[model samples]
Target chain A: MNFSHIDLLSFKSSPSPQKPLTLAPWRKLLYIKQEYPDNYVDESFLENLQKNVNFQSFDYFALCRESTVITEHISSVLIFVAVFIQLYHDHLDPHLLVSLGSAFVFLGCIIWEWCLARPAPPMHKSFLKTAAVFFLTLLGLSPILRTLTQGISSDSIWAMSVCLFITNILFFDYSSDLTYSIQFPGSVALNAAVFACVLLASRLSTNLHAFGFMSFALEWFALFPIFRRYLKRIMPTGHLIQTLLLVAITFVLFWPISRAIAVLYMIAVFSLTFICPIWLIFIQRYKNEIHGPWDEARPKVHRFRSPQR
Target chain B: MPALNICLASDFFYPNTGGVEAHLYSLSQCLLRRGHKVIIITHAYGKRTGVRYLSDGLKVYYIPGLVIYNQATLPTVFGNFPIFRYIFIREQIQVIHGHGSLSPFCHEAILHARTMGLKACFTDHSLFGFADTGSIITNKMLKFTLSDIDHVICVSHTSKENTVLRAALNPLNVSAIPNAIVGSLLKPDPTAADPEWITIVVACRLVYRKGIDLLVAIIPRICHQYPRVKFIIGGDGPRRIDLEQMRESYVLQDRVELLGAVQAADIHKLLVRGNIFLNTSLTEAFCIGIVEAACCGLLVVTTKVGGVPEVLPEHIIKFAAPEEDDLVRAVSLAIETVHVRDQRPELDPFVLHETVKRMYSWMDVAVRTERVYYSIMKVEAPPLIERLRRYYGCGQWAGKLFCILAAIDFLLYLFLEWAFPRQNIEIAPRFDHKRYVEKAVWRH
Candidate 1:
């Protein structure tokens, strides 16, 4: 018999009370054999089969709203690529890019402080102190990094950087929980981005160019995600605006390099942000997560006083 | 009816002591008593290898394999097929019964059994959730393994539900047969004259999933609520340190006793010392430990999780939500009830023992299990195309993948048959058959 077609709800045992059917009181389980056959699926067999009971329905708009985080993350990666390409081509000066990036980072910190609803600290001193220490470390490491992959071919270096950058974007933590100070996606993602930055920086001629790029990469990859998380938490509208502004800036920067590529990137961004959510909603009808009394219970424990009390 | 040769496959057995191991041994013994030839096939432990016979002439084949975490053999698909085939041919096995979901050996055995066109039965002993990544992968594997199996058995109704969802098996094919205790071993101690202090016993592996954290959190509160209460914990794991730390920080050294890992034989003795048996497990399929404790006349107070609530009648058990405060409240109530009952002397240990004996026994489980076997044997093996059709409903890509896997397994079986002809292998001598005697059923 084809067992898959056996509908648990429909397969009732023959109710004919023949041969003095020992009708025992209905219990969930019993060792003593009842008159029913071994395969007799009673009415209560699938009574607890709860279908999609714990399933949370998704609203199209809310889902689209949530996809904004993915869009923002992709936009940031694209903007960083655009900036790196311009710097590599010598279309943008290293000193000017570093100064502008630092200024934006400072502005971002102030907005982040406001979002956190905290009185701003003496920003210039702490910011400069952190920047000084970061730049000093980068300066010391720039020479080593410049020659780290000196023997490798430029094509291999470029290919490896692309893969690492893709890894960075794929593993980025986009979960809404921002309570953790360390952030999700943890060290593996950060290491991938930093390795990609080091690889890209090695292509530059001078140590200072590599140093500037590395510092900016730190601010972009490490600090920017924390800032984005705070912005999303504090002002959702500002978060959307930030995503849009980043996308526009990336498009404008890349338009000069290749118009077709810039147009394709924008289309990809829009499709990922809008079309994906619609696709998710369309597929939500197929979501059939079956949960019942069988699943392991998550323990809920609160603090208890010491026995000495 | 002619008796059939059955091979019980699992990673757990005699050398290793666990609930599944005991269940397998007892079930095999009972099946043997009922005139069916049964042999166990498990991974070789430390030095024990090749075929060995346990007491009552039950044969065990300890196949040499790489033992990984928790003594489960590393899942090398098709690695054990040649030896398994040889064993099947040598034993002239008709049915292959696999136990324990976590046992990759059992899963592989079931897969190979179906490839060889033998009737395969699986017994799931634990509950699993669908949320976690590990569970997702395991569930998919279970679905693949069970796609073509003839029958599935679960230790509890909750477990039956879980296995059905995990493997997508027909509910009719999956029987809810619970693990049973040897009722004779758990006779209650009647010599303890004074019941002034209410001792609560907890004997389980102190793992996170076993709710050791909840146990640690509630111990202090429960002890403080009732001054006469004392805790005796058994079994040890990585979380035992946390429990010890809790005891130290709470200064409960005198009141709470930690008897690190006790033998299975000593559990009944421990339960008899305590008036209440506490189970703080986050999940359980069919808690044989709780049943054994109940058989020893200890009032059971357990979290209402998994198959625990259905294991015992409500009157003997006090249910608590799987939370620290709720467990404390439940244990406190049980302590009060036990204390009052002790004063009245109305609580009969013999009655509790009788109730537990009636509820669960190895012979009963074996009888039910044998019935499942009979039912499955009545039906002939479905055509390969029909089996493939069933597997094709698993998922889109997974269905195709499973079909490929099933086809490959079939080809491998053909290759093994060609390489080592079944007639070339020597058949193992069977045990002398005993005449079956019907024991009178004890009814309440």
Candidate 2:
């Protein structure tokens, strides 16, 4: 809103007993005891005010494209759950799932080594070293993990998994910036996904099922997010294709279980990617940022360079 | 004009010293001097509870209430209405003047006063931005409270604009009445300044908003530039360590003195000791610090943020953007001015003090505030239905909510009147200012 209306409204509201020209011109200074009434506002009122100083206007297509990160994250999460459901029903072999996940991780590492804008830093522990240690630890923990939730009902297990997954999706860092270090909320999201994986692992029948499922869950939850963020930055087209592939996989896998669920999933993915961005852009006109002298000044500290010459 | 019974409501008053507290006390005194009955209403500060009298027979009602934070009373919309109504009826207060926009007690008082059909005028002590959760909430509350206000007073023109925008008030109702300091208290000491050292006094709570960060950034560069210059930093807060660290790292301990947590009474002495008073506030409504410093005959170097520019004349004060390099440059210019002034024999602290005294006197503020009081009294009080309509226009959701609150406040007002019954409450005897002064004060 133009603040000039305030000057006019305030002037119009008052009972102007004398002509404004009859008095000395109004100055903004408080030091001067002017002849005019205290409330008498002139043209100079709110002259220094500036609105929408740092506002960013968004485009509909750009917003829709940007929203793909959310759709991609949701789709990938649903695909993992579908795979979990397949393993739960004994439709997918645990050994085959583990081998496929390992092969994918190996290919992702090759791409990470070659295609990164800033090449993946020299690994503190090489992927193989950490994977071996983790594999050995999981091998020992499999028997204990399989029997962990045997006493609990399956309904409660399903409910708890859904809750943990929701928590993960809500806190997940969707930003694709490599410079953005993991904050506490992002860490919470990562941990929630891992915890959900461990919970679902308890429901599996055999030790190999638990171990193999747990390994795929780790590969999907932990490492995949980092990879997806990199995919968007390094290869935007590949990222879009990857998102479409995840949605299709979720749909195809869920269709065998229930056709209604597959159709619902497709609609959710479509609206999240398409309709939500349009709604966001629709509300962008409501953005009103008022900036003037009242804002806290960001101190510009200049670095003192000592004279060496 | 007949003497008006004015109740000044704010959570800030004596026992907790600050700008708002000082404004209340002195403004009350000046109002009393003008033959108006001025009483301050504030929350209790420790054992200083109940009604107490200060100099000039200005009565302060220390209304006991829970202080939520920074001495602001908990915003119970209708909780304080009973006692407020009882006080209003008993004292026969015709005008309710509230101070400090941040003070919830003041806001509540204004709300209840409108319910009681008394003319309410609010004075905004600070400027607020339209960002941040705290500001957004405060601005909304201000809007609800000031929607039906009789008049509004801001401490500066910049502050007036801020209030008009924040509360959506008509500019004609919101006047720019700058806060005034007690001139007799801040007598400049010509002998206090050191001849050899160019002492620059820095006084404020060492917080980020006060631009203590800028002070920390610029001090070393300023010291490095001038060999004879030194700093006397006063007041303490969370950012005090940064200032200490800056001093220690630069190893200019001898050049810089950190006088931690200086009281209000000692600010004049601190200002007098330096040739320049340096203020680096990020946002100020109308900084009385620069006024007090200018009164002490010190060259004022302040950032050109908020109303700092409007407070002092250009010759006495130098303004800079709230940046490290600009502030350092401003200080350099102030140091140069001080040096040039040192060569002349025409430097007189009394003349500077007199100029400030003329520019800002509590009597002038009181007279202007009196004019506001008189003007508001002329305004017809809006009925409850009309008032609800005013609140309904405050916002979409908040407007409806404000209307509900106002309706409930009216109901509370009805309950208080029936419960306490104004007839049962004995009217407090009005203090005869003239008779008391002539008999007790002059007789001694």
Candidate 3:
């Protein structure tokens, strides 16, 4: 779907009076001392605002609009539960699953290196090597992390894990491009996830279980996000397929539980995904985001420094 | 009309150096001069905790709290309610005026003040964009805080417009009040007899938003054309490298002086040393520095962005588009205009005095703010219809949600007072009432 048109459509709906906006007494410029003795808004204002309300329905149709968000969240939760079920049933050895995930991650990194090596200059190769070494060091330190939280109580661990998960959700930088310089939000979430895994690993009875958890952590925290971003960028259709497959797998795994609970969860998630878009569309009827000259002017950076210092 | 006791609440206050912090201090002092008691409630900074007194008997209470990024205190929404109530009762504060949008402390204070049935006024000192995630979240939070504010104050007409749009508030409820600098502090130097070199002084934090990049990009081209022109850049930030690179790129070592950061006291002296005050900031709520430069009798060459154009009259300023080429052209025009001028540049103190007086005065702000207080108190309770009207305008779902929040807040206030009756709570006396001079003359 082309997003450019939607933006244009939204912009065109602005209250365009015949006179030039600049010369008007109510020019949005913040500097002048204009007296608005009476109320700025009225029934007429709301009536004017209503012109753009119906546009929301077309922009945010149920089933189509919110399905992407719901699918991703649901799939991630299902994948986690599936991994735990496989561990409990011993259908797949934890160590083997851990090793497979680690190998896949390493292979993904190699692919990334190969891809970068084509377009990037030789100088950038050194930076990529440094990044590789950094990841290697992190992998080397994983075992130490597994044992670091031995002294903490189980109750504390449970509370800490919950806090970490919430942090991951709250601070997750949803921007697919990762164009921001800081990326503090994504980094914080990754850090919290790493901390949670380390604390959880310490409770494991065997070194194998600890290593399995650490490897799984690397797959989930580091590589999965990269894969997700790549898929989102390239084959977004595959994401839908993956989401559906995960849902089917979760339903099959949780068949032993009362069918009602599974059905209830499905109904709730489906309603949320479908109903939210409608709600959002309804709400958009009143989304009169007032833009005036007083709002801060965004600085456009004309000069971009070459990668070379 | 009697002088009212007013409390100015903000996360940023004295000892903090910025346009907003300075404005708060000077305005509070001016309000004090009007015989109105001004008290400030801000988060604790350094060792400046508990009750402290500044010049002119202006009282400040730096309540202890964890200072977050850029000195904005951690926002524990309902935590400060009890202490705030105590302070309000003790000080006999008729008005609660909050400052700065980033200050969640002030927002919380305003909410609590409204909940306590006190008149609450808010002053937004910075501009924000509607785009970007940070701004979207900030705007939402601002709307939540501003939903029930009695009146809103902005430093400039631009700021007022921005605030009204950003918070979805009624424009009539908001007032455009420009910031003022001490005209005496920034007086033009009469003693120095330097050559008529077109010295351009750029004094601002060398940050991306300040348009330091624009200045850095244009300075070299400007220098090559006009050899008599010299540049003095002040303030330091992450963008120092860009400026340094530009300096080296242009090989303008002797022509440009980079005084990494200059003290506030030296700003006036430095400003007066230059013929042109160059501001290339992309965004400014109300530029105090440019006003100070104007006050110092410097010919202004500034980007006509944000509140810069509104700050100075067209005759006094040479305005430029916020582009490198335009700024250079503007500077050239200003230099040419100065060279061809027959009379000495008008450094009329009266112009500034009138401009500043017309826009805002601390006493005027205090009086305006005081009216909100009495309006809230005079009524037994806010009518549901009025509440619904205000809330309904916020947004569709948000309007209904806000109406619910307002109702909950109103009920919570009654429940709190009833549960812990005010009669049982003893009010503390004034900490200190030291007599001071320089009371502002009340015009009314």
TM-score for candidate 2 (chain B) = 0.97
Deviation (Å) of B34 in candidate 3: 1.4
> Across residues B1-444, which tens digit of lDDT does each residue of candidate 2 receive?
899999999999878878998999888888897899988889999898998989878888898899988788888888788888888888999999998988989999999999989999899989888989999999999999899888889999889989999999878777888999888888889899998999999898888889887888888888889999999999988999998878788888999999998888888889999999999998999999999998988888999999888888887789998888788889999898887885544345677888887899898888878877777777777778889999999889999999999999898888888887889998989989988777785554
User: Model 1: which residue pairs collide?
Assistant: none
lDDT of 3: 0.69
Number of backbone-clashing residue pairs for each candidate, in the order shown: 0, 0, 8
Residue-level lDDT of model 2, residues A168-251, one tens digit each, is 899988774642356667888888888888788888878999999988988887788888887787789998898888888888
DockQ (C-alpha based) per candidate is: 0.38, 0.45, 0.16
TM-score for each of the candidates: 0.89, 0.92, 0.63
Q: Mark the 10 consecutive residues where model 2 chain B has the least summed lDDT.
A: B342-351
The candidate maximizing TM-score is 2
What would the per-residue lDDT of candidate 1 be over residues A69-161, giving only the tens digit for each residue?
888888888888888888888877889877987888878766655556453232454766877787788789899988897788899988998
**Chain B TM-score against the true chain B, each candidate:** 0.95, 0.97, 0.87
lDDT tens string, model 3, B16-117? 778878878888877676567889999899998999888767789999989878899887776777788778877888788899989988988887787776
Q: Using lDDT, give the best candidate's number.
A: 2
Q: Which is the better candidate, 1 or 3, if ranked by DockQ?
A: 1
B334-434: candidate 1 lDDT, tens digit per residue? 88888576554425677888888888888878877876676567667776787788778899999998888888888898998898888899988777744
